[model samples]
Target: MEIMQSLTDGIMLGGIYGVISIGLSLVFGVLGVVNFAQAQFLMLGMYVSWTLWKLLGIDPILGIPLTGAVVFIIGYLIEKTLIQRILKAPPVAQIFLTVGLMIFLENAVLLIYGSSFQSVVVSYQSLGFHIGSLFISAPYLMAFTAAVIVCAGLWIFLSRSWFGKAIRATSQDSDAAVLCGINVKQVYALAFSIGVALTAIGGAVILPYMTVSPSVGGQFSILMFTVVVLGGLGNVAGALVGGLVVGIIQSLSTMVFPVQLQNLILFIVFIGILAFKPEGLLKEK
Candidate 1:
């Protein structure tokens, strides 16, 4: 029964994990750039939602779209101004650029919002339903449900929209896409924007359950990267699977490992995966 409960909770948590990490996969898929600052965008999303709630009384879940839109614009501008310049640069340059940006964003948020943690109260914040002996958290359930719905809509948008097709083509072969008049540069910006937007939405939905702080992004950065890598970098579908696996690992480990060691376990797994299955568990062996 304990194992069952852990599994259930893990799956619920994994849903949010998947949603937040999918953007990383998408960005790599389309732009071939690993965004080290992706977690900062998630932080930005949380702040956006928190601010909207504090000022206008809008619920975080209800403000997800708006949060996403705002983040998308910010991402677009950043891509155009900074990321684009590094697209053709060496991997070291790309990594440093994003890492630097991450530091900047973190400090900027700290300066603006202070270092204190902030959270929002919602009607369902403390609500939960019982399933036999298992208790399901309302916040987790709602966040998971919203993630699924959003992912479904995103899949449709990618498959049916012209821009989506263009993004896909660019991802496959930017040179070829350019020859086909796809405007690879524009597609790159669009893909980055969309990626960050998705992450922001995930952050917004999880706001009710999670506290927001300037440094919150530091906590999720490795976890998000782990999900993307486990799912196979640049594989959107793989992120979902990776997230579930990570969630389960995290949840079950709590039974045997100390709280401080949970991250050690994840780091060990991450190293093992890189050494043995760097292509990711979801990829064809």
Candidate 2:
């Protein structure tokens, strides 16, 4: 029963993890740039949601669209002004640029929001339901549901929309896409914007169960990377599978290992995957 409970919790947590990591995967897939600053966008989303809750009396969960929109605009501007310049630079330059962006975002948020931690006080923050002996957390369930909806929507957008098809074409071969009349630069900017927006939405959904601080993105940075790598860096569907695998590992680890060692275990899995299957559990599309 205890194991079953952990599994349930893990699934809920994994769904959110998958959503957050999908943006990272998408950015890398389309741009061929590994964005070290992606998690900061998640932090930005959390702040957006928290602010809406505090100032406008909006529920954090209810403010997800606003959070996503705000972050999406920020992402679009950043990609156009900053990332677009480095798209063809050497890998080291790209890495350094993103790392610098990550630092800037962290300190910028710190300067504005200060060092205080913030969280939302939603009505269902502490609520839960039981199915026999297995308990499900209300916040987790809501976040998971939202994550699913967002992912499904993304899949439809990517697979069906005209712009989505253009994005896909650009990802497969930018030069070829250009020859075919697709605006490759525009696709890059849109893809980067959408990628970060998805991550921010993930962050907003989890506000009920997590606190937001400037450094919170640091906590998720490594986890997000692990999920992306485990699923395959550019494989969107793989990210979801990786998230489930990671969430289950984390949940079950707490049963036998100290809470402090949870990350240690994750690090081990990450290392093992890199060593054995660096291409990831899924083949790149």
Candidate 3:
């Protein structure tokens, strides 16, 4: 039963990681850009949730829409004002732009929030339910559920909606999509916006499990990037799978390896995957 509880906890954590990484995959898929600044977006979402819950007394769940709306608009504006102009330039431009964005957002956030760590002081977090004699934190369960809904919504948007299809078409071949009267630039902007919004949602949902700090976004960025690559760049399903696999590895490592070395286990697996199947388990169309 102790073992069972640990396994359950591992799976729950992995679900959150997988959900968080999907946005990274989506942005890479459509924009052909490695958005190093994704961490800042995650931070923004978390900060908003912290603000709402810790400051305004709103629940974190209720803050989702507020965070999402803010990040979505910021994403759209960022792309329109800066990213769109460099779409046709070399890929290096995207990298540089993203790096610049990383510095800007980080510094801006520090100036706004300062270095003080923030957390939502909720008493319910300590409360947990036992399944088969294993304790499960309420926050992990909540995070898992929220992550699923958000990812499912993204999948539906990509598979069912016309604009989603347009994004897909553009991802496959932007020139061909253009011939079909799809506005490639518009699709890119919207896709970036949606992708950033995903990270925001993740931040808001997982705040209960994590403390808010400027540097935390950088940590999320690395984890999400690993998930994106393992899942395959541009492959949403692959990212999901990759996220779960990473979560499992991380969870298991706590038992088998030293606490400090747990992160290394994930790196070993990720490198193995990259070497064995660079395209990922599920290749996007």
lDDT of 1 by residue, 19-57 (tens): 999999999998989999999999999999999999999
Q: Please provide, for model 2 over 1-285, each residue's C-alpha lDDT reduced to its tens digit, 9 standing for 90 to 100.
A: 899988988888898999999999999999999999999999999999999999998987788889999999999999999999999899999999999999999999999999999988988999998889888889899999999999999999999999999989988999999999999999999999999999999989999999999999999988999999999998989999999989999999999999999999999999999999999999785
Give the TM-score (vs. native) of candidate 2: 0.99
Q: What TM-score, over all chains together, does every model reach?
A: 0.97, 0.99, 0.95
* Model 3 bad stretches (over 4 Å): none
Model 2 scores worst on lDDT over the 10 consecutive residues at 57-66
Candidate 2 residues lying further than 4 Å off, grouped into runs, are none
- State the lDDT of candidate 3 residue by residue for 197-225, as single tens digits: 88888899889878988878877776787
Give the runs in model 1 whose Cα sits over 4 Å from its true position: none
Please give the distance, in angstroms, between residue 179's alpha carbon in candidate 1 and its true position after superposition. Answer: 2.0
Full candidate order by TM-score, most accurate first: 2, 1, 3
Instruction: Arrange candidates, best lDDT first.
Output: 2, 1, 3
How high is the lDDT of residue 197 in model 3? 88
**Winning model by TM-score:** 2
